[model samples]
Target chain A: MVIPITTGKGRSSRMHEFWEALTDPHVDFLRIALLMGLLASLAFGMTGSLVVVKRISYVAGAISHAVLGGIGAALYLQTVHGLEWMHPLLGALLAALLAAVIIAWIRNNGFQREDSVIGAVWAGGMATGLVFISKTPGFVDPMSYLFGNILILSRTDLYLVSILDLLLLGILFVQYNRLQALCFDEEQARLRGIRVGWYYTLLLCLIACTVVLLVSVVGIVLVVALLTIPAAMAGQHVRSLGAMMALSSLLTLFFVSLGIVIGFLGDWPAGPAIILVAGVAYLLQSLLKRVAA
Target chain B: MSEPAVIDCTEITVRYGPVTVLDKVSFVVPERRTLCIVGPNGGGKSTLLKVLLGLVRPQSGTVRVLGREPRQARMRVGYMPQYVQIDPLFPIDVEGIVRMGRLKGRGLGFYTREDRMATRQALEEVGLWEQRREAYINLSGGMKQRVLIARALVNNPELLLLDEPTAMVDAHIEARLLEKLKELHNRMTILLVSHDATFVSGLVDEVLCVNRTAEIHPVERVRDKSVTRLYGEPVQHVVHGHTHHHGEGEEQPDA
Candidate 1:
């Protein structure tokens, strides 16, 4: 699993090296990383559409920032207590689900002001993570998790991402109409006996899972950008939620793949490059729409 | 007018912490008739509607919608909240919006042929069948109101509840909506909530004046001074044959 870090290499040599790494059976991290990006795009597209339309990007952002706490705790436990099974990804999934449920509970129960609670969770999660990371024994580079390193992803990460993809597809297959109703008009949906609270909680849980997937691809700070930008851009053109999901999924795949390639060519960081490309394209789309109008 | 009660509320009382939003409110709407619930803002108009729809729980009173609990009868009840309550930028078309009404508490099943037929019929009833493919965001305010009405109609409920249907639309659109509701009155029980009671007085069979407490009066009796006492001001009544007036405090209550 040792990956040689080659920087300041010529553009042509880097391109040649990436291709060589992709084809070399013994060195397949590059290929796995590319496949991971493609797989993550499916989730980014579907859940991102719901997140954007439901106007819960702040909630999603809170859930994502909360993931760092889980990762840090898992790293601390594994390093100090020899808890070999407590993988950082497992810790992340648990933390994301916990954050989603807490936020949903607060909203459903009316216990506290929602935005303030979300703000607390958003900052509190990161602060907790920072403390845990500081306490860990090894020199853990938080930057890799704060801003992801797609090249370091493993076969296990690929399997986890695939499971998440299938899980999301299955949920959407069953709950698409209900989710649509929930998003468009919650009160009417409740009048129809749609269990608006439960569906809302379920939607947040899905967003939690999607945030975990994005964390592996783009990390925490950049997850919201990748999660929302494609769907927001797609919304400007599509007339239906389904079409928005489809178009956004394509856009996500395009940005992730192109960003990966460009990062390889220019010897740049992959996660931020992907976000930068998405940000630029979104700005361009908005500009073009204004001009057309 | 003894067609059986479609909605029966017995001493319904609702309180938000220390503030009692509704107190000892009780009324009934007969089947196949239109009833307008009129009141000032924050006077429990919307809360009463929520009680009927089983959204807000009462501390001590019982609510029976169509001879069953409000939640139990939800599938048989169609509700149209103010169109302003919906997100204007929601990315759904007319057909998609109407199809949402067919969701019967089951999250897994696909839309059936019966659902599609009902959607089409609802759209046609609202006179928006031709615009079913148009995005809801692109629709005008009047058309948005119609789309909401169509959504409420898609389920073919026995009881229909509309909240502030004429809030943002013009007089002409309100008249057209009135015509549509009058046509629907022959099939189902209708309860509409409005702060401006005069706009719907011509079409409703009764008017329920609410201000923390509740009282029901026949539509013809709404012009009586007691209705004015309920509002603490003079209330205008629109006669069927006269041109509608938009000016404030210029027209007299029709005798």
Candidate 2:
């Protein structure tokens, strides 16, 4: 039940009902959304910061969109052949990783322009997914994949997100300094004996996995906005990458939590609401800075 | 016994698609000696530096640095690129940029005490210690070049490679930087690419004039005529009063 605002005794009762709805163990949807929001902040904060700083948001967008191909393939196999072990998320991870590798290779080795390569993969991936989904012989809501319904998340999705989040966090923690060098000057990073090629590939691969995990929360279409907006805001005010990451994560938490609550109350899509909140926050921050100046 | 050449390249040729950048070029820098590579834009000066760094593989060449392939000796070589293209909005301070030099040997760990000390000494040497906490992207162009120099210096490399270190600095700062390089030259081998022929004349032991091909000339032999020959056009040397000043005296080539 959506909470209703009132000025009298009815307000108090509605507040109690809202609290009960959140606390009720049987109504796990809100709890899942809350957990997803927290995890999204932690994951996107780090990933988004790197994505923006390295100027690879376009690459990330390509990988994220490419995951749908895998999702569709997995669904087709599972539904048609009764392959119970083939999870859609697994398919998505593989698809994203493959797309990241291909995109990076094209950007590095191909003489052609990078945007053209990314553009081709971007549309090709979605078309591939659509073709597979159409042939699945049953009613599968594309909205769930294209525009994520966080309220419908299963425990499995949370597990997948958590495992991937830990992997991302672990990789970042281990290679923080190397990443800093890579981000600063890749040529110098190479002279410093850091394998620039390997690290770049690893980073893109990590982005691929991160995109796959985020698809269930923000969907494929809005994930880039969710990934970049908070981190971009934090980058303006912070002096170190570590500080930027911490601040971005906190901002993500604020935007995601507020957006989830607003979406629940106002009956709107949570992902778009979260991105809208972040965009508005960024605008407000810029305006405040301009005014102060 | 004399030390082997720090850098030894024999018949090096580099090509990018249809264009041949460095055509069958050869040069060597003796140990503890400084060499200045003079050439016009797109004359493969930067490409030469990349080859030495093993960043660019030559189409045909044999390159040896400190008795090994350039790639093998890359860890022991400190390279400062021509242009510092770091985004102005990047969130990195001076100390952080300087600390990146120490990231060579260590893998996936925090900076060590030695790393910190090296960063401090490098920053202090460049007179940027007070501004160590300042953002690198906000620094003046000269200051930014010095910061990059400090990054190169932090590693205590056997061979220091600088690409147009003085290109962005003013005349006064260029003079000071030259003095610093003179002092630094006594300790390690330096190979720098410069657009200004006269800036490093007194400082460099020898001059390697690079066009599409290459030639090693004695400091005295590198006159205004040589620069005209190098760029294939009369050079309007900026900053210095002399039209072509290749270090005041006649220092004979030992190449």
Candidate 3:
């Protein structure tokens, strides 16, 4: 259900309407959407830091784009094959993990030029997703999945996001040192007897999980923006990875919250609004830093 | 007889798809002695180091580092790679980088108090303890190289392998690093690889020259014959308190 915008009403009334929609017991989708955004910020902050530091934003981008294939397949399967249990989110997770593993394998094995393989996977996954999406029965709006509607998210997505956040935090707690080593210097990590290949694959898998979490908030097309922008911004000011993660998490939370408010106020799509705030903030920060320097 | 060998390799051969990088190379480095492997670029100096680090497996060879297989002895061996392999923009500090040396394949655990202590000691040893909190990217090239040394020393390993530690540093930093290595020579076995013969001439107990094949010569023998033969060109040889420039320049004797 689209939240009706009081176009002719004053700004205060619109905010009141948003606040009421959030607190109303009978209508808690807005509250749920806000909670989903906040929880997803944790995963985004951490994984995005890793993606930026390891210089694998391209790999993360590939994984995010590839998620479309899984979403499309799930939609097709549920509609055409009568597989009621095939959730699009599950399909997205699987496809993301598969794409991550394949990319990691190619990188470890040196089977092909890594960029070429990444390019193929990036384009191939999108094409596959589009084909499956078109083949599905009924009038499904692909735009909703390509660019998400956080306002329409269900309680189920919220639970999934919470669970993923916990899993990501737990893994990070245990593997922080190794992951740091892997990102900093794989060869030294190897000499220190850390399994570089396994850790690399594991890092990618974590990135995959984070991408799926992001998909729920920003959809497929804009997922890379949210995954990278806040982290990049945080990297500019922070001196260490942990600090970068914390600062980026706060930045993501800020952008997400402000974007949601702006989207609600203007009756705009929340995802793009969030990305715009983040993009503009990043540009302004860069300009300020340059001027100050 | 000589001291028990800390590094013993017999007929080790490494090839990358028929391009033989190290062909039947053999060398022995005794305990507590510094061995410098000097050779030209693409002469398998780095490849030989990888073979010892168990990073590159040779086609046929028996290799022992600290009397055990390279992989088995990896935990007790510290390695500083030739290049600073990390991105300069990486958000890590000197302490963070050095702490990586304490990772021991445990898969999941934080650094222990002992790990912290070792990191401090390593940093202090390299005279970078004051700058431990500094951003690695903000450090000078010399300090960055020193940080890598501190990382390799953090574990207090029995063997330290440094590949071209003086490659990019200026002369002042090189002398400082040379002094640091001299102090370390009293405790651990050091295997340093460099293409520049003059830089390592004073510190090494022996020189292992490699150009696809390998040969070991005493430091005294390196001044005239071995270095000249290995590089296939006349080069400067710095012996104790003396400098000899071959082929085109006069020999300048130092006090």
Candidate 4:
């Protein structure tokens, strides 16, 4: 595997004509972005498996949309409060988790009519964030939020993402059995004294954390697809409810990485192209599962 | 053995939208006792059991099991769902399904040896210990019912709620299942829901009749008129040694 590095490698590799040949900033940015697209898909796929096992596609989508508000919160904090302590992903995650808690509370409290409220929040969040973005001075470009500046993945970004991913995987593994039970039957889960509300909240937090990296890498536009398709496809193929997750994470990495390479060669937009790759994989897996059965 | 009320339901009422399935019903299922919910089709038998297990909440009622709410009491409770409508090809093995009963804790972890032992004991109790390795789909109807019971029993529940446990079984196997239930009732509290009023009446200490309303009847006098009063049924049940038979004009009984 080619290990990712920064700084001295570029400077030292300048002597080699082939490595030095691509001097265009646009091409270099795009090249890095292709890799970022793959990483985004991996994050999305892992989170998707979480969504699938929890049967929370609607919740995930609602949470993803809620991230828009999180982004706005981060912006507001940084600008108004002059707090450099905020990161975009962290802010978004906090907001999304809050939304999850609210949704679960509403559902448990018999406020069945409030599901539509999530949709309203979705629109309102994006609109609020967009308006904030427009009013910000010297912001230059907001393309990073809509599409992505994946080409700008510094070494620090990769390291941060790697740590986050490990933490996510660790949390999932530690509570593996509980996740399986929660996936199968919530009633049974609660009977086992699994605080259904709290676990649900934790799941939302994990999903939000996962989505933060996904949004950062691939932008919000393509993140939802990456979060849903692979896990869904994996669920249909795997025998046990738990195995579906392992398969999903693997499938997610494969398609997204593959898509990035394809987009790289084709001079295409990496985020959307990578997500399409996952879609195609899902279609193929469906066909295969059908044939096997 | 200490005799506690494994399932205690009082003034429980269940409604499905506009249709009220069970009206204010009360019962105390003492440990080592068998209580059956017997009535015609569309009677509130299943709903009553569900309420007792906290699977379905009653609109206005008080329910308790082992001195706790049904939902909280569920850990010590085992359930055998009806086999009539389920597809055979549910993609689980007989023993695997049984294992689910024991490993149902909130935490994430591998099942322990104790869980495996429970599965073995439950299978043996149901007489399918020999066929423990069989695919659930490959089993006959009676065998499937036994397997379902085994699944519930594996949890070593203090209370067992059997919803139409023998509905799809053959007559001979139904009798055999009855024997197994009799043996199980010597240890845990058992509640079975079925339209086979006379049959269940012979097996249990008491019969709880449920239609739109619930009426408790002792085993000695659960005749057709009592059945009709609770369920408005035209059918008649003749009690045999332990089996209940509907007359020729009676519609097909669903469990």
Candidate 5:
């Protein structure tokens, strides 16, 4: 369906046919993608922007980019070992958590200025993927790794995304106060017997696991941006962290839906288009802030 | 308030890189005693409070509050760090900020009935109950400081460490805050730090002066005219352990 130019434009595109059967207008593919993308962005943005806080933006980038290697490695293992138990999605998630633990261990131990180490890991992982894919028997496409194809919205991806979104929401609902205390002033939280370090480690692992799957939908390049920019705008616009999270989610959905439509109509890429949409919104917000100031 | 010492620091030494901020400082805060730590800039007064509250680590020291380490017993230590250092526009409301104090026992749950009671009690204690749900950004500097103090108090800690609580408030507000502290003095031990030497006396039972060499002053030293006039007489000092002081003191010691 997403094969070549005019293939999707043809009246018989898989998505078009699927949409034609729908009761609503033919804006089906673009609409769902938009809704999913925005929800995905909203969750990611609220989480990602906090990295800019806790002074962990670069650290988070390191983790985010490093997750690529984890996914690639997991995919390779499933192929080579033929692990019957290893589903692609679960394998990807497991690999990411393992990677997160390893990174956390190393950085906390001796790999000081983990940002540089993470950057190294990022480039190294991508390079490793390139090599592994080439050496493997199948002609795997790396474009999806660098830039995701949202059109390939598999049922598995959607289910996993739904679960991840729910997990995030649940955790937030239960631990919003504790997470806030930890994020803003860990000492204060710790002094109150919050186990500041453990909760944080858990948060990082959760974020890493979530990003592993999210990157599949939005890709690494756009994942953090979509997550952060909307939250950043929300941070500026809303006076409360809770409001910021909610607003970020709404804006993410709005921009993503718009981006998906533009991508569909123009036959462009989804990942980059979604990021650009958020980026544009951010720029506008900045302009508005400056003007008001 | 016959409870044992809430904060007991035994030879705590804090260092930032190669610089020693607090060197082998030790103190015992009995229940309901207000301990005031005072010193010039960079004298490690605030650092001591942070270390006491487990905000900063001491290179060498053992701190115990309620018979546990500060980190392990953090729920028992209410801290009001220097409000000047925090971003005032941080996305929170007066009520939301106060609600943050109950985070310890609530852990990851929704604000329970107990948490609401605690938050309301704390806000009421600080006299900000009426402005509970107001946006934090809209508050005056003095009101914001009170809210921070209230947040610390929400956890019902045995010891409260307030770093320069009266720094940003007006004279009248500072006096009002002092009254509030006096009321709270019955509930918990207090450790306060300030540069306003004038407010040192008549507030606290003991004085910790960190002037390069950190040491504790007997309660009577605060009332000493020479010592009071040195920093400035009628200076705000921690009573019992509460720090209560008058606002207008520009007099410097040996200046």
Candidate 6:
């Protein structure tokens, strides 16, 4: 019920209303959502390109969910123990980074059951979150964190996302070749005196940070789809990693805006709507490719 | 006068858990020499190559390339692994693949003007210069293998290591490719690991037979019996276009 639905409003009128609100300077909430959506899309494009090229979508998923444990712990500490210093976002960031580093370490060290370890971490994180949530004194609505409500996004959240997006761009810009080499042939990269372990851990940590930023808008469950689908679609049409990132960012922006409009008129959840739009696009693209072939 | 060794190893031992993949192996390759390493599948051929490239750390051996540690000389060495199938869906052109060879230092973005020139030169060497802009996924199998070689060559290293370069190439292409390799051999030191002796017959100056251990001898000293003994199985060697098969008990030429 966050976005009000009208009985007789047509799609074109709704779009006009949306356009007016977007251009209006006084409509700060809508503006905040727009900025957050654009910044989040940028992060999604950069990290999604790495995730798909390096074939680590599942690890990105585990990191996204593992951040929930941090959120739950922060809430429990602040509410039940009266810890004023601990914040949920901080907790989420720390947990996400730790989970990413641990999973990447396990993989690089040649663990016998790396996937099983990822699964364990994934489930363990969710379980820990559930436990903390149960122990907290107040009744907290889980729906907001599980399926995102962009209406709740604050100006501070927009600033935080912008900072994270800047960090991703800076690091990716500086280490583009090294990262590309790692994705193409890790063994060759290692032979070239590039520390495969160091860069791999860095890549995962970047994914972790991006996941934390994404969870604020899409929640834990749906961020992976948002991260991957646009990149995969762009991959089919582009010839380089850089092109994929650029094109996917535009595609992600389109999906996010479309989903926001749909959610507004239908009074539905925005995150899932955005994912559905992307998923349907992927399916259609695949079918069209098969037909053309 | 003796040329300094481009590669020198002393008592190198590599182990994976309880399995000793390479056992106290030692060898030397002088500068500008073409050395071919012939061994069985499990006889530590690729492992030896890894040791030379510093990809695998030996428990006890000291390795030096160009009078420096293998790790330090990595930038000066170029390598092509055995036919590793790149995902056909990978979205990179042939030039992009070869440009990876020029990735020597930490760079932030796209290739430079010099890097592009080197990539073009490498592609032309392999006779695939015109196809530089073609998607790597669209190339034929033989073309892909050649593309990998061009990638290894783009860096213009003083020493090149190739593992089974012609493993998947067609018979006719393999012969022409070996001829091309012989031309490249005059300019740089080359270390190659291959099981197809017929293809490498005249291209190699020396053959190092490895079977958990290693021994170096001139190419003329390698007979069908020596290969069979190294492999511990029957080996067929083509001499003067005739296949000569040898068994384990067959007499080996001078050791």
Please name the candidate that would achieve the greatest lDDT relative to the true structure: 1
Model 2 Cα shift for residue A157 (angstroms): 2.6
**TM-scores across all candidates?**
0.93, 0.91, 0.94, 0.77, 0.81, 0.91
- Give lDDT tens digits, candidate 5, residues B1-255: 555877778888887788987778777767788767776667777677676666677878788877887666776777887777666656787888788777654334467788889889989988899997787777888888888898988878887888888786667777777787788778778788866544544467777777545666676644345344444345544433444444344433310
- Ranking according to DockQ, highest score first: 3, 1, 2, 6, 5, 4
**Model 4 ranges with Cα > 4 A deviation:** A1-46, A76-84, A138-143, A147-150, A289-293, B1-24, B39-47, B54-73, B82-100, B103-110, B123-148, B164-186, B195-205, B233-255
> Which 10 residues in a row give candidate 6 chain B its minimum summed lDDT?
B246-255
**Model 1 stretches astray by more than 4 angstroms:** A1-26, B233-251
lDDT of 2 at B187: 90
Residue by residue across A94-148, what tens digits does model 5's lDDT show?
Answer: 6567656766666545556666666776677666656666665676676776677
Model 5 lDDT at residue B127: 87
lDDT of 3 by residue, B1-255 (tens): 778989999999999987999988888888998888887789999899898998898999899999999999988898987546668898988899898888877646589899999999999999999998999889998899989999999988899999888777777888888899999989999999876566776788888889999988877776544566667887765543456775444653110
Q: Which pairs, if any, clash in model 1?
A: none
Superposed Cα RMSD, model 3 = 2.7
- lDDT tens digits, residue span B118-222, model 6: 999999999999998888768887788888889888888889999988776677778777887988899899999887765786778898888899999798788
The per-candidate count of clashes, in order, stands at 0, 2, 0, 1, 32, 0
lDDT of each: 0.87, 0.83, 0.86, 0.68, 0.69, 0.83
Report lDDT (Cα) of residue B191, candidate 1.
92
Q: What is the interface RMSD of each candidate, in Å?
A: 1.1, 1.6, 1.1, 4.2, 2.3, 2.2
Scored by TM against the true chain B, the candidates give 0.91, 0.91, 0.91, 0.87, 0.81, 0.92
Better of 1 and 6 by DockQ: 1
lDDT by residue for model 3 (A73-139), tens:
9999999999989988889899999999999999999899999989988888899999999999887
True lDDT of residue A288, candidate 1: 88
Between candidates 1 and 4, the lDDT winner: 1
lDDT of 4 by residue, A208-266 (tens): 77766667655766677777787777765545544656667677667766665554444
Once model 3 is optimally superposed onto the true structure by TM-score, how far is the C-alpha of residue B16 displaced, in angstroms? 1.5
